[model samples]
Target: MSTKRYCLTCDLKDDEALIAEYKEYHKSVWPEIITSIKEAGIVDMQIYLSGNRMFMIMECDETFDPVKKAEMDANNPKVQEWEQLMWKYQQGLPWAKPGEKWIEMEKVFQL
Candidate 1:
């Protein structure tokens, strides 16, 4: 299967306590959510942070479709619960679409 990489950006609440809590939550992601991620065709994912900004890199098989994955997550009660908790520390980028949480970043250069 073909593999694709996606880059996404989001903003975290600038509060230190919130950021700390966010990191703590990620230290042990829910098992159910982890299963959902694999089922969605995502093989690898990483998040990096600077100041209040966050960047996520994801590698997935050709079967992965962000829209489809999001739809599936929406229907999953556990994923929805996790997302609701995460919203406490997340903010959409200023230029993101109304309902968007993470904005896909355009790749400029690659070697």
Candidate 2:
């Protein structure tokens, strides 16, 4: 099986305490969220933090469709809850649309 990779970027609230809290929450992500992610066809995912900046690496099979996942998440109460909770720490890039989050990064170099 082959997989595709995507990188996304977002910014945190830039408060030390809030950043610590955010990392703690990631230490044990809820089971429901894990299941939802797998169901979305994501093969592997990881997030990294640098100061107030955040980057996510998502690897998925051809079955993954981000648009479809967004639709599914919209109807899932657990997802809604998770998103609302994360909003306390996450912020969209300045160039992002009003309601957009996790702006996709362009792959300028690959080898």
Candidate 3:
């Protein structure tokens, strides 16, 4: 099976204590969230932090449809709860739409 990779970025409120708390929460994400991700066809995911900036890498199967995933998430109470909790620490990029988080990054280079 072919895998597609996507990179996304977001920002955290520039508060040290809040950032620490955010990391702690990630250390024990709700199991339902993990299952939801896999059910969305996301085979692998990783997140990295730099200062107040955050980046995520996701590898998904061909079956992954972002729109479908959004619909599924909307119907899942656990996912909605997780998103609401995450917003405490996450902020949209400067150019992001009013409700957008994790903006997708453009790939400008490849070896």
Candidate 4:
């Protein structure tokens, strides 16, 4: 079976202390967040950071559906709480829709 890959980008507040706190929180993410991701059909996910910018890579199975995932997240209190907590460190991209956190990246090249 083939896996679908998605790349997204977001930014964190430019303050150093806040960035550090953000990293620390990630070191031990809440269990509910992990479960939610797995249930959403994300096989693997990774985040990379540079200064205040962040890049995320997600590999998902065929069952993954962004709209369905969003609906699921909205209904899960733990997920909502986690998202709210994350917003403290996250900032939407300039062109992102209102309330959008991670902006999906366009694929321009592949080998």
Candidate 5:
């Protein structure tokens, strides 16, 4: 079993509205997003949120490449649409550039 780890973060400006929207979208994430993840060899994924901060953890197989996954996402029309829609309820870190929503975190510890 591959034990790779990756992380991503986004913000929730308006707590109630953001939470509701997040929950609703997660109830059925876009099919293309799921397909893209699986295609990239992502084996397991989880997301956690506290107040306005969101974190995503992912485990990927040998074939996984974050850069490639990002390229795929950029090229997929459905994924683009989904991302655009999602941005309406999400915010990026202060350091993130204008069009960027999720920012990767460096892993500092593992046990």
Candidate 6:
């Protein structure tokens, strides 16, 4: 398995609401969304949050491409829906571009 790490950040304000929404929605992530993720070659995925920052860790096959995964997400209706709903509880950093809910982080170290 190939392991990779990515990062994203949201706002700490309304963290309770954000966590609640995350828990609630994850209880039933749409089938298509799950399929899309798996199909994109993601073997395992996890997100960790502290303050308002989120760190995403993913393990995937050699075929995984972050660019392709993003394209698939953009074209998937379920993903769009989920993102829209999530935005209700989350806030983006001031530097985030318009319409961007999550800002990807730079990878600086790996062990």
Clashing pairs in 4: none
Residue range with the least summed lDDT across 10 consecutive positions in model 4: 91-100
Candidate 4 off by > 4 Å:
none
What local distance difference test score does each model get? 0.94, 0.93, 0.96, 0.96, 0.86, 0.74
lDDT tens digits, residue span 36-108, model 1 = 9999999999999999999999999998998899899999999999999999999989898876788889999
Residue 68 error for model 4, in Å?
Answer: 0.6
Against the true structure, what is each candidate's TM-score? 0.96, 0.97, 0.98, 0.97, 0.89, 0.75
Which should have the higher TM-score, number 3 or number 5? 3
For residue 50, give model 3's deviation from the true position in Å.
0.4
lDDT of 5 by residue, 1-111 (tens): 756888988786767976788878998998888998899889988889888788999889999988898899899999889988888788778899988888888878889
* Highest TM-score model number: 3
What value does the lDDT take at residue 52 in candidate 6?
56
* lDDT for residue 75 in candidate 6, whole number 0-100: 90
Reference-based lDDT, residue 90, model 3: 92
Comparing 1 with 6 on TM-score, the higher-scoring candidate is 1
Residue-level lDDT of model 3, residues 6-89, one tens digit each, is 999999999999999999999998999999999999999999999999999999999999999999999999999999999999
Model 1's C-alpha root-mean-square deviation from the true structure amounts to 0.9
Query: How high a TM-score does candidate 1 get?
Result: 0.96
Output candidate 2 Cα RMSD: 0.7
lDDT rank order: 3, 4, 1, 2, 5, 6
Residue-level lDDT tens digits of model 2 in 1-111:
889998999999889999999999999998899999999999899999999999999999999998999998998999899999999999888898987889889999979
Number of backbone clashes in candidate 2: 0
Error of 5 at 91 (Å): 0.9
